[model samples]
Target: MNKIIWLFPFVLSTLYVSAQKKTDRKTLSNLQMHVAYLASDKLEGRRTGTPGEQLAAAYIAGQMKDIGLTPMGEEGFLQTFTVKEGREPAADTKMSIGDQILTPGTQFIPLPFSAASSAKGEVIPNVNEPDNIWLVNVSEMDITNPHESMANQYLKEAKEAQQAGATAVVFYNSKETAAEVAEWLDQNPAPIPVPAVWVNDAVSKKLMADDAEGFKINLQVAFKPTKRTGTNVIGYIDNKAEKTIILGAHYDHLGYGEDHNGLGTATKEIYNGADDNASGTAALLEIARLLKASKLRGNNYAIVAFSGEELGLFGSKYFTEHSQIALSQANFMINMDMVGRLTAEKGLQIGGIGTSPAWNTILPAVAPKELKLSYDSAGVGPSDHTSFYRKNIPVLFFFTGTHSDYHKPTDDAGKLNYDGALSVVKLVYDIIDKANGMDKLTFSKTREPQMGTNARFSVTLGIMPDYTFDKGGVRIDGVTDGRPASKAGMAAGDVIVQMGSLPVTNLEAYMQALGTFKKGDQTDVKVKRGNAEKVFQVQF
Candidate 1:
């Protein structure tokens, strides 16, 4: 009996040691494997609702299954959702104003946001009648002013035209306005509330100056809206505890270098968002493995690999709203995003710091010495964590900061700091370890980050500057329709080397130079396109 008792203690010790090994530092090889496949070109950027994303979802589900986690999704490990996909305009679209047939590219272009509709009516100046087509001139409107004001004006005018029962509205603008509108269409390529067309200055002049009896307009705008499918992978460990802890990571990224990509130069390159999210997804898998091997106390665990995050927070939003376990039973949530490029000196940026009081004390206490930390009290930012915060749940967001390759095709697996990511994951594990047996985390409201909800700039160049461009000049990725940059003949791939007399070396310089210009100001903007330096006149 004495010998048996001694052997019982030895057996217990062996089991404990084995468990410790499973929960210890995650293997670098495993991280590499997950990242390699997730960010591989074969996956084609894993865009939400695409076959690539479906493949990634299947892989995550397989990993969770291997980790011995119970499926919590509607279909085994999958929580599927539907989204509306917009179709491109048909090439055979036709439009005519009076006796003149307008060319699609040169004289006028149908806004991509227009729904499929055909209308023929008398062309009237402004919106006086509900049955007529309205024409509004925006040549005098200052393009350099804040977009909110200009956008507000467009909204106000469109609402009036709609209220007047106008079937369509034609905007008369300069070449700049045409370019600005083109850029806007690139970013918001979906059906708008009203049908609209943008016509050049010459067309506007002919409409206003010519005899009114024959002034009629006809247009055939085309678009098709279809349903798209998306999936979210949910895994769980039922500890039968009162509250559940959640861990999540977004796995979706931009595909084929669309409007979101900060194109260094215009070319069809796949945006492999390895660091943007593959790193976070890989970390999620590693953490799930560790948690499966660890013994929990008084709480269940749920891990979600979210899709449709690039389009918005569709996966997290759906899960929180339709979770099998009530959201009220959620103890807290932690999110990992862009954790691959962790710079030791810069450390990690932990958002939603003020969401829980315990975090203020607990985070500092358990933070590893090897990891540097920056805290943002805001619970609201541009990520999946915001969805949980809206539910009054305490949340923590881990980010490795932004870089030149962010949202660009160059963001590949080779650029990731693997050791740095390991440190970050370890820190997250320690935080969880401390909170294992604690009471449900208390929720607190945090001040929203400035960049969260507002555009702080005094003026805009009417162009979308590539936020990830590290080059000498501010690279124009998308020019807004009817904006000054468009008026200045600035196109995508054009680098603004000089704004007025100011030498623009980078994004900051460009913004600063733009601030110096006010509404109605005119200046020469210099751009580097190919090997040639071209200067164009811009009216702010």
Candidate 2:
């Protein structure tokens, strides 16, 4: 009887220990496999539509199949879509102002959003006209400093000029304002209603100084829009529940060190976004494995590996718009982004806590002692979760926060905290457990955070500034196709060393430099293309 009792406990303990070792091995091995492959050099940073991205999609789809999850995408496990990637200037372009012939890429740049058409007419300052080209001088406006709201005004005025029957609009402003206008153009895929040009202060003054009467302007610009393909891998675990839970992670990263590479380093080097997404992606796969193996399948699970997220939630937005499974049945969504870098102290940052009343309550209860939860109420941030939140669906975003290696070639798999990632996966599993089979979560709208603003000013630089650049100077990730920066031949990867007479050492300095200019002003912008320094004149 004593042997029976002793041996029974020993046998049970041995089996439990063996099972634990097996689990530990599986967890680490599975996570490592996913992150290693997804963030490996062979994947080539997995930019949307690229061969690397296709490979990633195939791998994810294969994994979904292995998990016994049914395909929840348009085609098997893939939901393919086309998006306007970017636009390039087409030939047959011309611009002239009376006797002065404006050279393309030197005197004026066409905004990417500008329509491909020809327009010629007398130039008049802020005059609403159908046949006349309107001249907008920033000096004439109430702009006194750099401000985010003022940046919108530039686009608003451009739309107004188009609506007022103006054939084109010419803006004269400071380098800062021109940068802002350029940025706005690059961001909005919609074409501008009319031709637009941003001339330097010198050009503005020269034009304004001349007689308004018989002042003719002629311009022609053609933009060739580029299309890029991306895929969203979706798999479903249906428990016949009316309300479903969604788990998502972006698998795309900056490809071949494009303009979006925050550090502005390495033009062609692969940016293997290991922690930026590979970690999150790995977590998703691990969670799926757990869910598949678990007995508790309370609610339906729709797990997605989104693509084109680096470009702006393209996959998530597309999935939400054309979901194979009705999004109306989605109770809530959990997004894992940049969750690979979780530290013992920093733990995890859970954004979108205010997105549902249930999150704040359920999070603490489910979170383990190992994790310290930092909460953020705002649902709208720079990730795919924002796409679902916009659809009135509650969301929870898991992140480990930014790191020194963010958006750079240095974000490789070797640097990921695998153990931390596994914990996050467990946390997600618990979160699902807490909400599964429950009544649909009440979606609450949280106020959106300020869009790209750290300082208030009147003037703006028109290019989309890469905020994550770890180096000196403000890095320009994207230039509006037809705005001042584009006209000035300034492009992505150009580091704005100086704007006008002020040094732009960082984003704050860049903003400070912008506040010094008003409308109808012009300034010289110095940029470092590589080791070479180049100067371009920008008008606001």
Candidate 3:
């Protein structure tokens, strides 16, 4: 420990070190209090752009100010942005559909970012009649090899039928249908450029029956697209601007869906996102408190809590890209996503190990061998860190693997494994300390092949699967993001029911059709939802 100097601030580094023992417990307790409130149910999973999220931002900013960290942006401690999504008035409104009294709330919801309007449209290419192709959900896995999945086959069939000019694509719900459907609807609901609506068992049968004459649908929905604010809560201790270490976490999760595990309505249950991200946010605050007490004052470390991670890492992406200072100020970005739980009570998954050469070298020096640091050769995965990685920044994402509770209401704080989280945080803290003192540790990308399953594959398809399509054959609510579907002049409202000679019924079927072809494969993908039956070529 260094000695104190006369009349100098923080000159007594020795005083800070010995005092660490006396302050550890109290500091940790304070951190726990802040995290507890941030992760509470009142925040509604801290969904981006929601009222609950706004409340969370206020709470976090207050905590940051209390810690004396400078605001990193013009908007106080908040880095704000808007995320577009589909939503409709709760299925409780009343309206008129031809002679029948059309109900507003439950039958349809406004698509995310759909134009605000009062819509009245007739059922074109009516699928309720016999002979119209309909989409249905199925479950057929390659159990013989768990590593290999044929999930895309379902989507392939739907694309084929849409090309055939199928009148409608009715869909069947899956085991995770409720949550997935809500997500689908939130991203892409019906009735923008084209007309589409979701139907339950009774409504679907009623519309399909011939007796359902004078069948007209009327809807009044409102959509707003002005601007919104979000935040990434951060606190720092800067003692003369040194190299930095970032302890970061995303404080967002998938909000409540249409149904909660098929047991209760989405409104009744909350997707607490406890493990999904609440756990990560909690750790960030705790680490700040720890370092503050330890007087680890040389480095300019930031403990950040990010928002909008569920809706595609919006908040973290903003902070890293639009920093007040240079992005290179920090040596490493250590992120914790779902570190509250451990699989088999034996290991934690550490992706990005293969992404950086330095990770492979330094991991052994700081982390336990038995704890098992896992990795994907590709440093990039579907998380907030991907934004940084794409920018050629060295990054690490900590995950505890996925579970049944992922993206579901069951992801509650009551289920969090605190001991597991503590262990992981301790391990990460050590890693940062080791890296902080190193002289210019250079990081290189590791382009390793993926091992087991491929969630997405690059194939020629000019259709977008709209979760809000509410039809069969892997409902097409929108076109693939930045794919041939978008380039071939396809729009979000267009649903693809068929591809080439195959019908895309579900994600599984869609995968199977794509599997039959190699790269540079071109084919006619058919999208027929909401009276628009057209075929487009998807070139590989």
Candidate 4:
């Protein structure tokens, strides 16, 4: 009896130590095997609903099975669905107004979903005014992103135009607006809205003159909406029925655009989303592998790789609302996005930290002391995780900050910082294993989202900023005019240097300072209007 009792303690200790080793920090390098394959050129850009995406899904499913993870859905590992492709304008279309043959890009741009319909109205005699005009009104359907999609500058502009009764937009290539728009396009080449057309300086001058005649516009513009299938590869650990833990990442990226620019060879411009997602997806697979290998189960854990995140968070949104799994059963969400760019200069950024008090206690302990971590409570931001937050699910999104490579064709597996990802994945596994072992976490009714400091305000700031901005911040995006910042003279091209009295050197600091004042509070703000810094303030 004495020997058995002694052995009992030793046996329990051995089991505990073995379980710990299953998810310890050193085992993350295992991601190398999975990430290399998933992010390889063989997967292409893994655009949602493409053969590449399906192949990735299959690989992930097979890995999950090999690691011994159970299938979560009825149809095996994939929680498959479809998304309506954005309206793509004809690439080689022609547009001309009166005497001017507008430049394809500079003078006129077609709406993505402008419909297969073409418009050729007599230049609304604006030509008699100095320029002939073709007023192409991009229909709301072709222009407006589905309400379920995350709102950005285009959506804000659409809302404003709708409110202003601005039926058509006239884009003129004067010295100013043309240059401004050119810079805008370099950063963002996504779909644009409008019954819009552009005019050259000479054309504008004619319109401005009294000799402009009855105008005529000939347009061969075309927009068509098609449906494409996207996949959400899922594998899970069946555990307690209580609250489930959702771990997700987006697996698609920019698809083929241009052809080979070298010699006589034809090379596809495939944007393999290695760091953009293959890294995160690989982490998910490795975590699933570890969990499966351990054969330890507790809270339900859903491991999913989402598609359509590049176009929008369509795959994630669809899965969150209409899932083979129950939403309420979800306790919280952890999203790993853009995690392959870890560096010593700029460490990790943890979002949604303030949403749940649990993170306050846990993340600090789980994060490594050697690295710097920035946390925020805005439980919502511009990512797939936002979809879950809107549904009231507390969420955490992990990012290693943005670089020039993000969304660019250069973002490939070759540029991924393997060691950096290894550190992050190890940290994540610690958190996941801890969350898996806990009884559902408690939540506070109100969360003060943090960017850098503890300044909490009751007001909401509306803007979808470019992810790469940090210090002397650049605003590549803006919200509707009636919103707080817009009403305060904040424009898209303006670089914000100071929000209030605080130096706005980084995103966290700016957010923290913004929290100091509430919706009704008015404050002074500084921005670079052009080459000069301008001071402006307004009542929120």
Candidate 5:
């Protein structure tokens, strides 16, 4: 998730500035050089699991090696993880009714939950004969219930057919209806026992036209699993201390806007996320250099360049779960993201202030007078810092704010504020230095904020949707107090399966369900908690 901070203007007292320091020429040059290469078109926006992301990881590793930081990853400085990149139809996937061959993607399409096997038998329309293909017609089904899922309906029908010893199940609509078969094609569900497929309206009409007699059908539903590997670069300055401080930044960006997460999705343009994260990664590199050469050795330092942050904090989450370093010895974590576009006001947004009491004292003392800082007390937000906060660790997230060029091709290296970024690096270093004298900071739980305010919807469930959940439905990461979700007893980790009369299949479906309601509306929200499904009455 992107760090979409909703800025509220605030400033620190000028008394905090004890002295003014000159900007180092070498630091500025290094920041610019790092951003220039990482955000350049040559890196293709450094999308995770791509060659571009690998190149960026290699470069960060090289920089860490040059700084003399000890490699801390499972493989030298690289920690790799596998990501499920959806699925694709195999070459053998085909369907035919006697001599009439049907196209795979157009005339007929296999659902993601279809069994990867072949089935052949005689088919009779609207017949549930044993050892025969079942042709289920959904033309007369009551699909008007908003809470009902067409995909689920198809799966239920297929399951019933399989129970009757059917060879396979095929779904189609004989008449015009609002329901679409294509909508069920992309859903991720558990595979059924037998092959299942959906045919387009043209093929459906052809099948129903010949329902008077049985026909031999040959069907195959085969899919190849699509996957990619994301790598995290880890380097440690082992001061031989009892505690370790972590510094992290994500280097992945939207590659040619292929993931549909970018602002400019209509064009095949490389979304060079300079301000989005390249700037933060550059700052991390410079910070590693400073810490490696610093005399403050009260705590060990772990510098990490994470990937797949734009894809729901995959890299950081993976590291925290499968860390080589002792997490129990972790002091705190500082995350830098989108720290390149500092305004003339020197505005900087810092989150997770409420995560630790030490931040309340250390931040104001070490902050420079030139910088106008706004703070969010929430320990959970749309960034990698939230991952650490979840583990009962203190966290701080630094960001300059969003811009018009955010998540677009226009966000290039030339637009970065090198001097401003360098200042941010210095401020982080100062905070670390001030905290060197203290013991590990105490962790505190704070309220989680909503992801963002979307203009498309007027009402909100007041929950942060977990973006990493791919199994189906929208999983709640956090629930805001005094909101609809909280009032209805919705808690974090609860997967919302239905909203009112609408079935919530995915994040987009959940958002659409939100748009259907208004203030003062009351509805029943169904969520899956553990092995049980519960319904809560919510008033919006």
Candidate 6:
């Protein structure tokens, strides 16, 4: 009897494998076609807000349309969002003292916080006359505070000059002590109302040489914020159900390493990101197809191909915040990121298991016996699913482990494991099939990861620094419980401006500051929360 029972189960498993093989041929073909085009050189790595990204969006929308899925975006399967690239001085920006013209970038450059306005007035030193350009010599200014940025000191001087009735402030340093002032421009800075300019050492020497005779100054400090539009492709399958399940994948990658997020040393070559996300995106389309044609109709499906994910979850965050569909009716969210490199030995990684209690039971039951699975309970990860999880929705994230080619130009279409991607697609389909008639999953909070974790550092604040925040300092995206940041009362959205005696000007500066500290150290951390700056005592 036992032998007969085992043979019956073996025969059923064989039948299932045969049926899956028959269907996988077409699925694999679709995966190959989608990946080849999306990861092709023609798409230019599909960097968000670029022409390549637009082409990828259009292609994804066309695929959704061909699948007979309903458009769920604001504009017929296309949802647009503005992405702030950075700021740059305008082409017409110019500065002149008498007849001598100062080059915009070489001789003189507008401060990052300078107002984009023109100022014409007589230049005079040590004269704080109203409606006149004041030349401030910062060569002898006190800069003893190690925690204060030199740029901030210049800004303070400008603010003082403005308060003293100066129309515009021109800063020049004659001493070598302030030689570092040349690197003062912040890539992303908050603008001040008053116009400010910093002249190079050569220009300063020239100005000082002609200081005896006051000259009429013509200054124009104009800056334009670099921005571009990123589109998210959305498609839906309306099953006439009470709840909708969201499936998402990012289709954007680093284009020629322009974003500086690529791991490869070569920036000229395209970081195709086929395994990073093209695989996930292709898998999403296949999952959408399976769900659309499946008999399960207990819940609706919203499949989204997100852009600007490589730029810090911009697309997914925007979608969750400004969703056209009712978020209150959102049953759950599933995200696929870097799902193309799965191997039998490397296995599959499934995150957000603790997000919903149902995941513990449902995942194991639907997971294929041939596939090894690892689980991460945290709902807050470095992916799009975190956006939905933040909205109090249950979430699941699928990933095939990173390889040597991750975030490199070699992560191309040829490196993808199409069979592995197919297995993931089928696994997700089975999960959806099993949960078709179940009640809405319950959300449960899990431990957050200590983002910004570096092996060189011994201490961590236990906060996820927002990679998209360019304006100065490191912004906290999330705070882990029982960590230094959370214990110190730091919360998400707070920008860490100063750590101990070091100025946290940017993410790099923050990491460097962390290296200065050891475990079991206590220090005062300053953060800008909303319009106010607050200090917290952190114990690390």
Candidate 1 per-residue lDDT, tens place, 1-540, comes to 999999999999999999656544345678888999999998888888888888899999999999999999999999998744534446766689767888765577666555467778875554357677777676644445344445445545555676778677777764444444544443354455567777777787776674554467898776433456679999998888899989999998887754343443445788889998999999999888877877855678899999878877888888888888788889999999999988756578888889999998889889877667778787877799999999999999998877657777888999999878777777888888889878899999987533323323444567766544556898876676566888778898799999889999876567667767757789999999989999999987
lDDT by residue for model 4 over 339-380, one digit each (tens)? 888888768888887667788777877888898787767777
User: What does candidate 6 score in Cα RMSD to the true structure?
Assistant: 10.4
Cα lDDT tens digits for candidate 5, 31-111: 999999998888899999999998899999999999999999999999998755566667899999989999876788787
Superposition error at 408 for model 3 (Å): 2.3
Minimum summed lDDT over a 10-residue window in model 1 is located at 449-458
The reply for model 2, stretches above 4 Å from the true place, is 90-223, 450-540
**Cα lDDT for residue 391, candidate 6:** 95
| lDDT (tens digit, per residue) of candidate 3 on 1-540 | 234445355545667766754455554455346456766778876766777777877877787777677776557777776555445444333334467664433443333422344445454323433334333333321234333322333234344444565433333333322333334444432333322233344455555466755445565545432444566776666756556766678886655542222112245666667777777777776676566655555567777778877767788788777776556776667788887766554267777776567877788888876576555445666677777776666778888765546666677766777767776767777777666566544566756324236544534453434322224665543344455666676675565577789987755567677766644567887876477688888766
Give each model a TM-score: 0.67, 0.65, 0.62, 0.60, 0.70, 0.70
In order, the Cα lDDT scores of the candidates are 0.78, 0.80, 0.59, 0.65, 0.83, 0.84
lDDT of 2 by residue, 1-540 (tens): 998998998999999999977886798889999999999899998988899999999999999999899998889999999855555556666788888887655466676557778888875554556767887775566544444455455667778778877788777754543334434444554678687767766676676674655577888887655667899999999888788889999998887855343443445788899997989998998898888887666678899999988877889999998997888888899999988887776668888999999887788889898677777787887899999999999999998867657767788888988888878888898888877656789999997643255544444455777644648998886665455777789988899989877888877677777776766579999999999999999876
Candidates 1 and 6, the one with greater lDDT? 6
Better structure of 2 and 6 per TM-score: 6
Give model 6's TM-score versus the native structure.
Answer: 0.70
Candidate 6 stretches greater than 4 Å from native: 1-19, 85-87, 95-109, 115-144, 149-151, 157-195, 198-219, 450-540
The residue pairs that clash in candidate 5, if any, are 146-501, 147-501
| RMSD to true structure for each model, in Å | 9.3, 10.4, 14.1, 10.9, 12.0, 10.4
Give the TM-score (vs. native) of candidate 3.
0.62
**Pairs with backbone N, CA or C atoms under 3 Å apart (clashes), candidate 6:** none
Select the stronger candidate by lDDT from 2 and 4: 2
- Model 1's alpha-carbon lDDT is 0.78
Query: Which 10 residues in a row give candidate 3 its minimum summed lDDT?
Result: 257-266
